[model samples]
Target: MIFEMTTQVRVSNFDEGRKWYETLLNKKPDFIPHEGFVEFELIPGCWLQIAEGKPTEGNGPLRLGVSNIESERERLIKELKIDKFEINSRPEVPVKWGTFKDPWGNHLGFFEYLDKDEEKKSIKNNLERTFN
Candidate 1:
């Protein structure tokens, strides 16, 4: 059974890539099993890997969930010096989101739920399922 998940985003330089991710994630990686690869355990069994190498074209906008999209976007701009990106929202949609590129052009984004109760419920359910 597929019980876990891992996603990779490549970078041309290990040092710069790792630093960028550190700033974005707001912490050091959980695992550095080798010289050029680093892993962050984003959730219980969910992993985000940053490996040093050439980046793939059209790879991803690896969106992460946050509590406040605008605040997070501002943090990214102030901390990482990212360009101001637009946050999109719609009445039919339950969340707001925005995307930005890392130094190596790896697409990354943050999304925030409009409904805090639903977001809390989803997080609790996901944690329970992942851990139990």
Candidate 2:
């Protein structure tokens, strides 16, 4: 059974990619296995790798969960200088989400649950898994 996972995105320039990712993540990479490659442990077992190479076209909108989508979107727009994107939701959907891209065109986004209790439960479950 699969217990852990990693997703990779490529960039044309290594240094610029590294700095952009660091700003987006708001932390230094958890691991830099070699030159031109770095990884961030987004959750306990989920990894996001950024590498130096040609970026894949139309690859992904690797969405991440957040506590507040609006604030997070604002932060990204202001800090990363990404084009403003709209957050969307439906009555049948439990979360609201928005998507944006990095300088190298790697798709990324944030989402937030409408139910605060569910959000708390998810956070608690993740914390338990992390500490256990």
Candidate 3:
């Protein structure tokens, strides 16, 4: 099964939002269907899009959990020519995640997950000891 999703952002201006998104995604809009709508298809199945409209009050607090965040961030800053993308947090928190916002005011983050293989090994070892 595939795990990909698209999130749309609302903004008053389309072109302004497009520029901001380009800076954040480090690429030109690849999924533009019209003048008012622009999309940055980050990967094969994932999408981040924006257009002319206002998201309802308390609409969402959407976040995209990106991997290898440091590398991806370096590429984005260099290739996108953004002035600066502030680092929202350090690695002190429980989530161990850092966040940044796009030009259109959409929040994004780099999330690290535990290694599954290590977890499986530990679980198996504990089960063996208990069962034996």
Per residue, candidate 1 scores C-alpha lDDT tens digits across 15-75 of: 9899989989998999999999999999889999999999988778999999988988989
Q: Per-residue CA lDDT of candidate 3, range 1-132, in tens? A: 545678888877777777766766667988778878888877556677787886445444565445455666676667654345444555554333455555445555564434546546765774665465
lDDT of each: 0.92, 0.91, 0.62
Kindly provide the TM-score of model 1 when superposed on the true structure, using C-alpha atoms: 0.96
lDDT comparison, 1 vs 3, better candidate: 1
Model 1: weakest 10-residue lDDT segment is 53-62
lDDT of 2 by residue, 15-80 (tens): 989998898888999999899999999989999999999999998899999998888888888888
Top TM-score model = 1
For lDDT, the strongest prediction is 1
Question: How many clashes show up per model?
Answer: 0, 0, 0
Name the TM-score of candidate 2. Answer: 0.95
Give the worst 10-residue stretch by lDDT in candidate 3: 87-96
